[model samples]
Target: MYVTFVGHVIEWRGPAPFYFVRVPEDECAGIQEVASAATYGWGVIPVSARIGEIDFSTSLFPKDGGYLLPIKNAVRKPQNLSAGDEVTVEMTVRL
Candidate 1:
């Protein structure tokens, strides 16, 4: 399924910094409908996404009843994105 949303970038300070864009609440419902079929394991859903001029594949990490789309450094740097920056994402849930 294809979906598009705009959200702010957030950082999780692990051993290394991890960045993500939270899927909007309104979008969660449709994702939940296909979650069971789409999640490979541990509630992680695989998706392909486009941000700015780049397209890449990544998995959505389930969190707090929603999903967080990881923004890899490869994609982020090219687009000049940083934490708290608003980004528009077009994604496809791979079912």
Candidate 2:
């Protein structure tokens, strides 16, 4: 299925780097940073894969009031992602 997720980069940690994205209305997902580069003075990271399984039970509220959700087995990095950068992501949800 094609799903559109709009969230902000909340946290980026670990050696491989994982993005903790916060969607609207307290929804969130993790997008693994696969590749990154500076383009036109803007940092652009290409998240080419998803992780784990899509489960709603892992949802929680961020300290800032937004919901926190894991991107399962995210295959991307979480660097340069700030805590409020409006992001529109398109991905294929698999079962």
How does model 2 score by TM-score? 0.34
Model 2 clash pairs are: 26-67, 30-71, 32-75, 32-76, 32-77, 33-76, 33-77, 51-73, 52-73
Compared with the true structure, the alpha-carbon lDDT of candidate 1 equals: 0.96
lDDT of 1 by residue, 1-95 (tens): 99999999999999999999999999889999999999999999999999999999999999999999999999999888999999999999999
Clashing pairs in 1: none
lDDT (0 to 1) per candidate: 0.96, 0.38
For model 2, the run of ten residues with the poorest summed lDDT: 32-41
How well does candidate 2 score on lDDT at residue 70?
46
Give the lDDT of residue 20 in candidate 2. 62
Candidate with top lDDT is 1
What are the models' TM-scores?
Answer: 0.98, 0.34
